[model samples]
Target chain A: MAIIFSSLNIAFSQNNDQGQLSGNFSVDAQVYKEDLDIGAEVPVEKMGLNSYANFLYTRGNFTAGIRYEGYMNAMLGFDSRYDGVGIPYRFITYRNDNLEITVGNFYEQFGSGLIFRSYEDKSLGIDNAIDGLRIKLNPYKGVYLKGFTGKQRSFFDFGPGIVRGMDGELFINEIFETLNNAKSQFILGGSFVSKYQKDEHVTLNLPENIGAFAGRFTFMRGGFNLSGEYAYKYADPHPDDPSGLYNYNTKFGDVILLNTTYSAKGLGVYLSVKRVDNMSFRSDINATLNDLQINYIPGITKTHTYSLASMYPYASQPNGEIGLQAEVIYNFSKGTALGGKYGTNVSVNFSRVNSLEVKPTANLDRFETEYFAIGDELYFQDFNIKVHKKINSKWKADVSYLNIIYNKDVIQGLAGYGTIYSNVGIVDVTYKLKPRHTLRMEVQALFTKQDHGDWSMGLLEYTIAPKWFINVSDQYNHGNSEKKNHYYNIAAGYKKGANRIQLGYGRQRAGIVCVGGICRNVPASSGFNISITSSF
Target chain B: MKKFIVVILFLSIGISLFSQSKNVPNVHIKNLNGEIVNAPDLFDGESLVILSFWATWCKPCIKELDAYNENIVDWAEETGVKLFAISVDNARSMSRVAPFVNGRGWENLDFYLDANEDFKRAMNVINVPHTLLLDGNGKILWQHTSYAEGDEYELYEAIKEQSAK
Candidate 1:
């Protein structure tokens, strides 16, 4: 390592400039000593390391770069495919005259990324880089066209399926000469993506072609702006559906999002709704659990900051679900009764999702019928609300309440488990000391007779200026039918200039980590974690 | 009059070509000192510059950087080379870059940042550590998507060959 660093220094120093060359790298190493078996089934590990690096150089309209990744001992709950090191991306790209081309691994997103999204989430160990060719063309002002054909990455390797897609977008202001000066502007876009994989008498015969398409429209006029997209997909079957009821066929689904915000003076309000079906967009036709993910689903439940409130975060069920979210942000005008001296900011948001009602026909063989009949029953639902108020310059407070209904059987594919209903409440307060110091406290409680039982949580955080912070939190399962479990953690961090270090010791419960709607399971563990970062 | 015509034709062609190139938006990135810097200014215009994002714990990243280090001087002499090593370590583990670099004795790399990932999102960087190559004109030239063992040699050859042209 020392020799490598010296060589790098010499390389950078000597190549001061001919064209540009720069790169960055990082490594995360952890030592884990597993305790007695709890709910976890995987073997306990002693240590693990996850690291990767990227290098790039460009001159003129041409650019070249590559990435290296290694996972010596994969993390718990993560797949082992990433344990090997190799080059995941290698390609040269050029852009000139409104045309851009890339040949190699690339990430892209169309619209809300609901149906077609090729992206990477390093923290969650998710990557779906497409190894192929991509092209973007802007034929005229405001008109954009994009197309790509590639195979998705599976760990250090590529998946068997081939993906091809095309999308077109038209910006109204630029496309319609007459609309350039209009008070209201509009933009529209549409996309279609298809995946092909050969099948050979697997458990079942799956469709070789699976396709998804979406159309989006956005209108902006004064204080009112609305954007929405409708996406649909053909039937796609998986090996998990033993009943063969949810077999791959030409399945139809759509996600409609309508966001309208009125911001005038100091008040704002927004509303959105989405419905999705069989939309678990992934790269590997067979990749499961922290592997080969290609798209994201939007979660309807609020992402709570408190431990207990976050314990049961709703992971979007891609196969079938409808969700709605609404939020209002209102700021009291200065000198108003509720505004106080500095004015007051108030916000409230709520969302819920449920499985589509499907009715199944009897007498038909279980394997021959559909997984769900039309007009059945709801799968899940959640309602939440929050209020935030600043009492004074030194103090601020927020309170929230949530009610949720989760179907453990459907969401987790676990047998013998029924639906769960839970109610959760949280309150947070922050106090300011002088100019650079602050302290925050959070208290939360969750009541449920469903999965995991009732729980309570508390967290405290203290920060001093730009360099130091300390946080402590605890979650206690007080109403469990089995033995009550208490989870606690304490962490502190210090930073000086570009360098920062953090130390943490804690006992944590397993939970789900989700982005957009994709998710990965985090295992329960108790240990010490130290992290150091610097640049220069 | 003929000379004037020729100049006009040349200017028009230059303008047309410039218009054809995609405009890369400028982004603000934090330096090792936590100070913000414009990305484009990192290149001094005299030599070919390579910008890479990496971390100490990443094995492949280490291998790639080490490979480049071995032949970087030769590549530099053959075609003026400059390299910037940007670390995307988040707030929790960002302090280790300098020490790690010192430990590795990488004398040729300068450090940059995407601490809050503002630069990453702007550049649409989805995976790490990813690399981006830029030309002296501050225009993105060629970007190899990812790296393998002998990939650095290929990169060096490309740089050398391009600079010579």
Candidate 2:
């Protein structure tokens, strides 16, 4: 721990030119003690810590960087595979004129990331960087090409399977001399990705090579824009489906996505539709959580912020589902009827997803589903509306309402538990009495007769200038009747320049913590958490 | 472990021997129009530039930018400072950024999208509402993370100092 701090101190102080050396460090640790009342049990290590520091040095057209991660027996919900620590990420690259190359680890993403995406998310405990070689070539002005081949990272070791991918994109408008100033622009691209593994099964004969291909396009005009992508994968076998509907033989998979948007001065509208079937592609056939993922199908639902409103976030149904999302936003100009001294903002969003209609096959290992038809079983649905208004120069208010339906049977992997229909309402306001001091208040309520019944919550936060902030909040499951639990917490923090330290103590009720569309269930516990962050 | 310490000391000494230059990274970001644009080229090269990394899911990030928009027209005249609210929302939530900003009528500030987080990672930004102040020469003057009610004043002060110089 001391050595880690020393390296951070050195990194934070050394920022200069002629090959600049700079980086950032973040460390999160907690002290956990057994709490019988809160169902918090003691772990082998009483103190758990997660720390990371990144150092980057760049000179002229050359760059090098390394990241050190240490998870001393990761936290409660995190996977134990991250028990040890080492330099998991290191890369060196050079870029000049029309060509560039990287010889170590790097993150890359293709169109919509449907066929290939390599990234790292510390919060979600995901890091699947490719360790081999990658190259990019701009042979022409409007043409871009990339190619790479490597093995995926699984925890501290590399996976057995090897991956190879290639992508090429062209800007039609830029490539053609006659259409330099065309009103509508066009961009086209294509990708091919393949993974290789040895056939080791005695009873089943598996293919040594599995491949996926994708083609995408984009068209943009003055105020209208549209983009779409279609991907198809060859037969591959895997057995980690939460649905538990098909588990034997492998079958082909496919995904289709299309989105369009239009915006004016004070109004904007957007809509997108997606359909996926057996699209869980990974390097390792049986990997779970966020390991060895070869593609990412972004969720099509609006991400809510308020606690109650976001209680049931929709994770993308990668296996098989069809979903549609639409949103409209309008702003009334100042000095108008709806817009008073300032203005009024209103937004409405709607989304729905359902399972695929599949017909049973002879072997029961593969299934068939149509491309366009909607299924009967509902996977998730959300409809929400929000309005914001400024009452005066010192006061502002916002109100929101959300209605959501979550299929617990599929989302939470609960066999017979049924769907959860919840309605959330929130009221948030801020008041300023002094030049550098302000008080904000938030009150929210979740109404439902299923699951844990009704829940009510409120929070108060006060801030002073640019240095200090204090917040306290509590949520009560009032309608449970059996166990009306009160999850209470208080936190205080101080900030200056690029440094911040926060101390929090609370009873963490059993729930889920999500980041970047990934979810992790956290067990209930009572303890103290300290976080320190600094960058130079 | 001993060799690690030795390497660290040598690196520090090497870093101290060289001086710094005034150049910001030439990263690319997508605008609301879905067109890729060089980050440092967004400004006209003669004034202070503010990069306020934000997200659609963060509440305070939205508030601080709203405050900047409220007094921006007048503030721009008083001090030649510009603000670009870079949304670090991925594809999962990036599509809504355009509508959200337009819905709020925050058209004064340029709303750029870092859909892939390429620029965010280039700046070593771990969280949203992280603000950076750059000079006319493209060198970062100062930066701060998180936000409070009066945080804007500190930014204004920094801009004032640069203009005075």
Candidate 3:
């Protein structure tokens, strides 16, 4: 293996048209030292590493690639199911003007992913890439059709169920040349997906086949645009969840999503709504948490990056939830009182999610729900406004305020931890010493009486030109009447071309680290971490 | 165990002969109006293009965009470079990318959404705030991962170096 890899690396040169080959490698590892003070238990191996390398060889109209991942005992927050090493992804592809085909491992999605989506997110420890066959055909102009049949990956293995999906899309405007020139454009799409698994339980009979269908449409013109999708799923009863709150009774599912936006020049407004009911489609019947999600319902609220503002983020509820999100963006013109010499940008956003107003009857296959009814229980709400401006050539600042009602018990499954009602404020500033050097700082605070009480955080970062950076930050649970634990970290990074290396030593607070709408719980720990990534 | 390591290494570099700047894959991404455009078309092979791969939910991504916007006029006037901010937001948050960019009044930048992450996976991007500098010939001359407070200065330098050539 070493001989082959060395040969390839040395053999490839600046020679261009000879069917180029490309790939990248990355590795992240952490060495743990038992910290009794912070409850960072020592792993049996004393260390954990996660590494992956992808190689793709493309020539002419054909391409093939493979990904190898190694997790030495897995990371602390990662799923232990990925304890070993294996080649989890590989694919061969061929494409032409009329048709495209792929075999082996692939990722795909239909419309808003209400019915089916196969993708990977290493941060969330979620990779459900399908292993099988996929085909795409454009038989007619302005029309796209795709179909796939495969089994979803579970850790190092494939799920027992075999899932299949088909999607078709037609651009109305393009299909009809007359409409193409019209001011308003339209697009129509539909999808059908299903799963089949063997029924093996002896005590209870279960449906081995579950299917869903969805249709979507969009219209856009000028500054106004609108789109929506409706989906329905066959009866799927799973009463054996770990929580034991759901009934094993047969149940059907449905979801509806609508979004609209209007924008021109410096002002824009957007509104989105989603309704989900009994929509817990999964590759595995009993998969829990961040595992086996066939469909993703992302958070409608803003994604806050400030340490304090994002402390308690909203988690999307794919099953039996209704949500609405609204946002407005306006830029005050330059040279105005509010705009200053440089224009000032102000953005306001609001989002809310609640339980669906649905009731179940004694019927064997049906549930009841009003089309627009909203449940009384509140899951999450976020209201925030931010203003950003450049004070001078060398200085810039941004200030933001956020109000949130986070249901920890419902979202994080913390039984006794009630909903947290908090308000957070943050100020970020950047100063440039020279054209090649700069410094940035952030100060943030959160006020709340629930959970860990009030909190505050501060961060400072310095950068030299493009290749070097160093930073330090700390968050304190100051509102806690008893414990005032400090979560602190210091890190640095160096970059050259497509290669980057980062090192850090820090104490992380025990909490849920979420990306997109998925999350992973990380335990409290103090350790040294190193990461190396390069692309060619 | 040694054999396994060797197999892994071989699989990673089995076909790599020498390292060269590979062209951006011909993946498809959608613009704000939901029109599919080839990924390489953004650069078009005739102009210096800066592709800033970002997401609405990412803070550093936003910061980098803001900084670039603040310096865009100057950057363009000085180097005749155009910037395209590609939002790698999936189906869940894709609807917000356009609105977010529009609301910020960053009209200086163009926005495209990668709904399924095809471009991201094809580009081998593991994180956001990853920026790529392309020459007039559509060759990716330089790329960087992560953003610091003053990374734009280095980017400008790279742009100047490319434009000079």
Interface DockQ per candidate: 0.03, 0.44, 0.35
- Cα lDDT listed for each candidate: 0.64, 0.82, 0.82
Q: Model 2: residues >4 Å from true position, as ranges?
A: A1-17, A241-243, B1-22, B43-46
How large is the interface RMSD of each prediction? 18.2, 4.4, 4.9
Q: What is the DockQ of the complex in model 3?
A: 0.35
- The DockQ value obtained for model 1 is 0.03
Clash count, candidate 3: 4
Error of 2 at B30 (Å): 2.0
Of the pair 1 and 3, which is ahead by DockQ? 3
- Kindly list the per-residue Cα lDDT of model 3 for residues A347-441, writing each as its tens digit: 89999999878676676445677768999889899999998888898998899999999988888866888789999999999898987688999
Cα lDDT tens digits, model 1, A367-408, are 222333332445666676665566777887777788877777
Residue A444, candidate 3: Cα error in Å is 1.2
Q: Write the per-residue lDDT of candidate 2 for residues A1-536, one digit (tens) a residue.
A: 54686556644543444456767899888888777665787787987888889877766566788988889878877788987789988988877656778888888888888889888777777889999899988798778899999999888889889989999988888889898899999989999999998877777777889999999998989867788999999988766544565464477989998988887789988899999888888898767777798988888888887888878878886788899999998998889999987888988999999999887779677778877788899999999999988889789898999999999787766778799999999999988878789898999999988888999999999998688889999988897867888878899999888888999988777776666556778788778988988876
Against the true structure, what is each candidate's TM-score? Answer: 0.72, 0.93, 0.93
Q: Which candidate is the best by DockQ?
A: 2
Badly placed stretches (over 4 Å) of model 3 are: A1-11, A14-16, A242-245, A363-367, B1-22, B70-82, B135-138
Q: Report the C-alpha lDDT of model 1 over B1-165, residue by residue, as the tens digit.
A: 667666755654564455432223234465543333667677675566777776543544654575576567787777887777767654222433443443343456677865545356434454454555667744444444333334565466568777876
Q: Residue A405: error of model 2 in Å?
A: 0.6
Scored against the true structure, residue A5 in model 1 reaches a CA lDDT of 46
